[model samples]
Target: MHQNPSMADIKVIIPAFNEGDSITKVIEEVPDFVSEIIVVNNNSTDDTFEKAKKAGATVLTETRKGYGHACLCGLHYIDKRSKTPDIVVFIDGDYSDYPEDMEKVVAPILNENIDFVVGARKKELREPGAMTPQQVFGNWLATFLMRLFFAAKYTDLGPFRAIKYKKLKELQMEDKTYGWTVEMQLKALRKKLTYKEVPVRYKKRIGVSKVSGTVKGTIFAGVKILGWIFKYSIR
Candidate 1:
């Protein structure tokens, strides 16, 4: 049904908010072989859009603020009225994820025909204090529950991930909050989609984090993520 030959033909979707400083760097690192790059500027107070546009990235704005909401906007753009790449790679605008590794993540999906892929950042590779104690425990509990209830296996719920566009659309993704990553993994598990994980180096992101810095943010994220996983299991 699609003519694109390999994952290189995929589009890179980066969700950014107030990342004016590092957006250009991430975009520049993306291999030239990529078909299209869309940066969803989620109501950035700074000149995020201008900088991304100048870097030759197709910039779109989502007034509402939320990681999942911004990505939903990007997906709508890609699904409804765009080139419709064979695969879609989601990367954060913070430049924490190595852009050069995009090829590494997508290769499994293209060559071996994996349905979706996640860039698993092992605990050993994660930087000191990169994950709060609460974060680490929450991830373990959540992944355990996912394996127990959904029978899914994933090490880290990292934002750096890739999936076939067709499978992505099949998921009918609806999370508009911090739980988006977990939600996607649960769906992939429930659907029994072929999945793979690759070793991706993790580093501190530019600027302060949005969800992990505050007590309220951390607790709310933990609650939302756990709630989504179980809620789907009952359905």
Candidate 2:
């Protein structure tokens, strides 16, 4: 069993795109045990950056508009930090995820020697219409494909996740779009990393989802997710 480390070393990375209304709430709800909160504003045309900064989160700007790009920007900032965190958590800035449940998300890693954990937004725990039909279908299809191809047991491609900083670097994540979450899961499988999922609560976001709220965003996301799965399956 891994030594239970102080939760103080935990850092949070929130990939925000135009989440002006919800960023502050998201940042504030994060548990006090966390060390640093990093929010990557993905070319927002609103006051997202200013609000996040004012909310006491270390904010960075990623002009390139993609979830993965914003996440990569946050990771890059952490890479330059002098003291590396023991665990890094990724949550959305849209306030859809319960930030307080972070303790549960990182528990296995801190106590069970697990290398990674993804917050599974259980259908029962999610608010009505929290996840679009396409999102639900896409998650099922992607995870089903992973199981069929790799015998991997995964349920949700949830954004609220935790991973050891060292193991995260080992994955060499490179997805710059919708493929981000699946790419991490796929690479973790390829590396045979110990992982688990903890159920997390989900609610409707404060603003319209750029991806699930629009037809174009939904189609692109579906294609990107499928493309990643097929590409890795062939490897």
Candidate 3:
């Protein structure tokens, strides 16, 4: 069994876009084992950058206004560091996920040598009205399609996930928008990486969701996610 992660080189990357109201709480709740908390401000028109920095996290700016872009910017920042972390955890700054549960999310990777882990947001564990109807349907359709096409076993494309840094590098992720989460899962399947899903609690976010809250955002996200699935299915 993994004794403890306190000595492990673990880092967290949170992608924030106008999550000023929740970013600080998200940062503060992270487990102590995390060596560094990197919050990528995705061109937030609010005080996301200031709040994240004030919370004692390493803040980076990605003016591209995309989830993937912000995550990529965080990865680039880590790449420049002299010492690379052993594990990288990706979480959203919206505070929907319980940051304290990160240890459970990373346990499989640390103990069983799992290459990737997804924090499955089971319906029983989610707060009421935490996920929009579009979000729920989108997750079901996307995971079902992935299973049908790739024989994968994923329940949700939850943003709360952990992966070995080296395996993550091997994925060569390129999505710059809403397709980021699905792209990572698809790539993991293609690479035949050992993976697992751990149940995690989800709650309502502090601010409006940028993707699932608006009509255009919902449609665009649906298209992007489906587009990635089909594109990978054909390959």
Candidate 4:
């Protein structure tokens, strides 16, 4: 929080996977204050790429087919830019999150000089069926473990989050799959970065969830999340 950046330098990165049905809506809803919207298509078999581009977003493709891979691709693109962004906000492409709420997501970094901010989909604000039972349990378990092991105060591993660009690179984020979100949170804690959570509204996604909608996905995600938590605990 040493530097205060203008809203024009705030950029957004969205990782989309077969989200053609909701890509445009997600892109359109992002606040006008954002400087650029970069969408990384995660090997989508649908028209997510074309639609996002048509919606006037800078679109890139990552054929690795993982959430973390897509996010890393977007970060790579920004790193090579002539003028890097001051802040980077990440959101899902499924349209489950309120894109307009990005103002609050990035507010901590912008207004209060906080290092990181996550949009907590508070239970009261989440629509019925927006989160699967497994997802709820997984988030609870992950945050609970972090609190127990590190005295951390995180509530949810929510995807809608904002972070200082420099702080993000300092994390050296490497998880290329289900463990991405938790990896960021844990690294932030280990590094002792200032962070906060803002409750945000959530709704049902336009299409089925790739991770939470299937047994395999749910199990893999759970294992990855817990693995990160335990590994950090031992350290």
The number of the candidate with the highest lDDT is: 3
Instruction: Estimate, for each residue in 118-206, the C-alpha lDDT of model 4 and write its tens digit.
Output: 99999999999999999999999999999999999999999999999999999999999999999999999999999999999999999
- Give per-residue CA lDDT, model 2, range 1-235, as digits (tens): 5544454499999999999999999999999889899999999999999999999999999999999999999999999999999899999999999998988999898888899999998999999999999889989999999999989889999999999999999999999988899999999999999999999999999999988999999999999998989998898
For each candidate, the alpha-carbon lDDT, in order, equals 0.86, 0.93, 0.95, 0.94
Rank by lDDT, descending? 3, 4, 2, 1
Which digits, one per residue and each the tens of the lDDT, describe model 3 over residues 1-235? Answer: 7748886899999999999999999999999999999999999999989989999999999999899999999999998999999999999999999999999999998899899999999999999999999999999999999999999999999999999999999999999999999999999999999999999999999988989999999999999999999999999
Q: What are the per-residue Cα lDDT tens digits for candidate 1 across 75-162?
A: 9998776468888999999877888888888888877889999998787877876767777788889888887886677878889999
Better candidate number, 3 or 4, judged by TM-score? 3
Flag the better candidate by lDDT, 1 or 4.
4
Off by over 4 Å in 1: 1-8
- Backbone collision tally, model 2: 0
**Which segments of model 3 are wrong by more than 4 Å?**
none
Pick by lDDT: 1 or 3, better one: 3
Q: What is the total number of backbone clashes in candidate 1?
A: 0
Clashes by residue pair, model 3:
none
TM-scores for the candidates: 0.93, 0.97, 0.99, 0.97
Candidate 1 to truth, TM: 0.93
- Return the lDDT, model 3, position 205: 91
